[model samples]
Structure formats: C-alpha cells, structure tokens
Target: MAVKIYGIKNCDTMAKARHWLEARGVEAVFHDYKALSIGQDVLEGWADRIGWQKLINTSGTTFRKLPDEDRADLDEAKALRLMQAQPSMIRRPILDTGDQLIAGFKPDIYENVFK
Candidate 1:
C-alpha cells in the first residue's frame, strides 16, 4: 500500500497532523474513518504491524465509554473487532508511510521517521 493517513477529519490531533504534512508538502492518501468504511482486513494488517495495544485509542472517549467488560481481556482479535466496530476507538492519524506504521502523532517522531 501507498502512504496513507487514517484519521477522523474533525479531530484536533488529526488537524495538526494534516497541517504538519501539508506544511512539508508530503503527499498522502487520507482515510477518513467518519466519512468512509475501514475494512477488517485493513485493521488486521495495521494490528499486525503496530500491535493491537498501540492501534487502540485508549485515550479516546469512544474507548472509555465502552463497557468495562468489553474493554477487558483484550487480545489482538478482540481489539481488532472493537476497532472495526467503532473506528473512533482506533488511534487518530495512524500514519502509514508506505514503509512503517505509526500509530499516533508525535511531531518529533514524525520528524525523525519522515526525515
């Protein structure tokens, strides 16, 4: 796959990431979770590369709102299912650089990775 930035457009962090990439003139395909559907296979591939722990957005409200039981005892399969069911539960701006899978945004990390 080519470089893709998977995120929700309205997300503040996503906005920052977009601006960062735009300022750098880095071309990337955007996968807006709110505007389009993310396939199970896609999420699975991401999980394989990044690990389900990093892929899941535990900091987000969607994940916090889930029942304790639902969030409990999560493995790759369970986390993948939850993320597939609620795309918002996936970390914002997962940057696929066509070589590596970045699960979340960090300017320094981005700098090093993209540089």
Candidate 2:
C-alpha cells in the first residue's frame, strides 16, 4: 500500500516531511485535513494505534489558546472533539505506512520507516 500523510498543506513541518519523502523517491498521498475535514472514525483509528494523547498537538497555538476549562481534564472523547473542531490542534505530518502510524517528522525515524 502507498504511504499516506495527514497534515495541513501549508505547514512547514508538512513541507519538510513531503520534501524528505520526495528526495528519497518515496511516493505518498497527502491528506490535508485543513481543506477537508477529518472523520471521527479515522481519528479514532489513529488514536487506537498511537494513543489519543499523541494525536493532539498540545504545543500548538490552537491548543495553547484554548480556555483552561477546555484544556483541563482531557480524555479520548474530549480530545477528539477538540481536534475535530480545530484540525490545527492536531499534530502535523502524521505518516501512515498502512502498517504503522508515525506522528511528526523526525529524520531518523523517517529513515528507519523507509528502511
């Protein structure tokens, strides 16, 4: 199966990840959740594989700007709602190799994935 990348099209990290894959001749289809909304089922599947905690981009401005009440007491359902409402709150460049899910862009990890 082909590699599938999920992220916002204009994200710098997404660009880096795409460039890295292209440089190595790795073909991947990018899913820009910003333009197209992500489904709850898809998000749930990812969460099951990598854990919901890893799916949320707590370090991003979207997350930081959230009211303390909304940010506090996070659980799978709450996190999913937050992410669905604001895709930017989700992490960038989530690489799905069909067999595994890789969150974020780490050169070494990506190299290992290709290898």
Candidate 3:
C-alpha cells in the first residue's frame, strides 16, 4: 500500500506521526503542505471525506488569528478557499493510504487505521 502523509514538517503532531510510522517500519511519502500546495479540488475531496469540522483546525493559531468576520459564518467553499490560501488552517497529519483517508494523529486511531 502506498501511504502518503501530508502536513507541515515542524508540526509536533506530524513529527510524532512520522516517528510512529518509522518505528513501525511503515514507509510513507511525506507531503509538506507548505512546500507543496494542495489545490482546491484536493482540499474539497479531503473535506468531503473528513467533513469540514474535521478538516478545519479551528484550535490552531492560524484560524484564531483570522478576523472575526472571516471566521464568522464560513461555508464549505469559503473554508476550502481559506485552507488553500493558508494550509496551516487545515488539521495536521492527513494520511492517505490509497483506500483510506485519515485526518489528524491520535495514536490509537493511527494504530487502528494504519495497521
């Protein structure tokens, strides 16, 4: 299975996820969003899979720093555009294993999905 992991390289959760995969001898292609931008279609696909709430990182500083109006009533299209413009607004450690798409990195979830 070809596993592709997407996130910012310096993110703590992403680092932990990478370490977990490495320790388990799982080889995954890492796609750093900052370095390689994701297009609107891809973002939409992810949102469709995980839902807007799951894809959007409202807890992150990037989202919190946005103007109140910007965060006020964001729909799917708007959220996708925002995430495309600022990849950090998306949740970290999105894993694509051909057949499945996993967003975020909880060890238990990773263990269950990746295994």
Worst 10 residues of 1 by lDDT: 28-37
Across 43-115, the per-residue lDDT of candidate 3 in tens digits comes to 9888888787788899899999999999988898888888999999889889999888888998998798766
Candidate 3 off by > 4 Å: none
User: What is the per-residue lDDT of model 1 for residues 1-115, given as tens digits with 9 covering 90 to 100?
Assistant: 6679999989999999989988988888998986796899999898788788998988889999999999899888998889888899989889998888898889998899779
lDDT tens digits by residue: candidate 2, 1-115: 8899999988999999999999999999999998998999999999999999999999999999999999999999999999999999889989999998999999999999899
For model 1, what is the alpha-carbon lDDT of residue 8?
94
Total clashes in model 3, counting residue pairs 3 or more apart in sequence or in different chains = 0
Give the poorly placed runs of model 1, Cα more than 4 Å off.
none
Residue 101, candidate 2: Cα error in Å is 0.4
Clash tally, candidates in order? 0, 0, 0
Cand. 2 Cα-lDDT: 0.95
Using lDDT, rank the candidates from best to worst.
Answer: 2, 3, 1
- Provide the RMSD of all predictions against the true structure, rounded to 1 decimal: 1.1, 0.6, 1.0
Evaluate residue 51 in candidate 3 and report its C-alpha lDDT on the 0 to 100 scale: 88
